[model samples]
Target: MNRRIGILISGRGSNMMALVERADGYDVALVASDKPDAPGLAWAKSRGIATFALSPKGIGKAGYEAQIDAALREAGVEIIALAGYMRLLSDDFVARWRGRIVNIHPSLLPRYKGLDTHARAIAAGDAVAGCSVHVVTEELDGGAVLGQAEVPIEPGDTPEILAARVLAAEHALYPRVLKEFVANERPNPA
Candidate 1:
């Protein structure tokens, strides 16, 4: 069966767009966001993909996560992909969907576990940078890694430059990983 995917985004959703354009054996069942004005919603709509918005502005974290869970179940989504989704999901939610949700992070995880990774790496004078595709876990960015693609941190490189390079890898890695996941027919440890 074609993998049914639901993507959650909070911004431009470049990775989501990449999946939509490249996914030949999968169905993008829904594209959802917490921000109604998120550019990605409009982008998804333009491509005739279903879109949803649930604002967490007033609703607390638990309430918001509850809604997300309901939404995913209602849509019959088999795989959940987080693409630039800024909010950290609740532990209960992550556990409920463990082995089914995946996220693309801007750093080769276990190295730069949280935000500002590019800057932190550059400031620390790291020689290389990359992105990771990993299974989602309760602990932020703490999951078994599926795959990663690295780029050299050139001399005098700014965070912005490094970020762009890493994002390019992200755009390529996520879909490839998803394809492998579907082909293997297993809940990969990552």
Candidate 2:
């Protein structure tokens, strides 16, 4: 049986769209977002995918996470994919999902752990930069990498230019890695 995956997004969810379009060996069970007005939610809804969106602004982190957790469980989601999800997950949330959460980072990882990855790579005079799909942990983008795709940084590459290329790589990398990850995970007990 295909594993059910829930995707979390904070914005356009271009990665989410890619996953949905190219899904194999797994099913996208739900698309949830911290930004209620996120464009991704609408796209998911239009495609007949179950979606839940709530802003965490006033509910506090704990409450917000609880609601998200409840929704995922309710949807029978076995894997959580962070696709352009900008919010930092609380340690509690990470611990709750543990090995089942995965995220795609814009950098090669173990290099640029936080934001501005493209800019940092350019400033450091790096020749190549790419994307990584890794298991999500408490530390920001600090998980064991499952796979990576390298994109050469051209001489005139600005962060925006580099970012666009990396995003394309991410779209291709995330689905394949997530499929392998789901296949490797131990099945839940009946």
Which segments of candidate 1 are over 4 A away from where they belong? 185-190
lDDT of 1 by residue, 1-190 (tens): 7878899999999999998988966789999998889999999999999888889978898988888778877887888999999989888888888788889999978898889999988988888989999989988898889999998999989999899999998999999987776566554332
- Against the hidden true structure, what lDDT does model 2 obtain? 0.94
Give the runs in model 2 whose Cα sits over 4 Å from its true position.
none
What's the CA RMSD of model 2 in angstroms?
1.1
- Per-residue alpha-carbon lDDT of model 2 for 1-190, expressed as tens digits? 9999999999999999999998998899999999999999999999999999999999999999999999999999988999999999999989889889999999998999999999999999999999999999999899899999999999999999999999999999998998899989976521
TM-score of each: 0.94, 0.98
Q: In model 1, state the lDDT of residue 53.
A: 89
Point to the candidate with the largest TM-score.
Answer: 2
TM-score of 1: 0.94
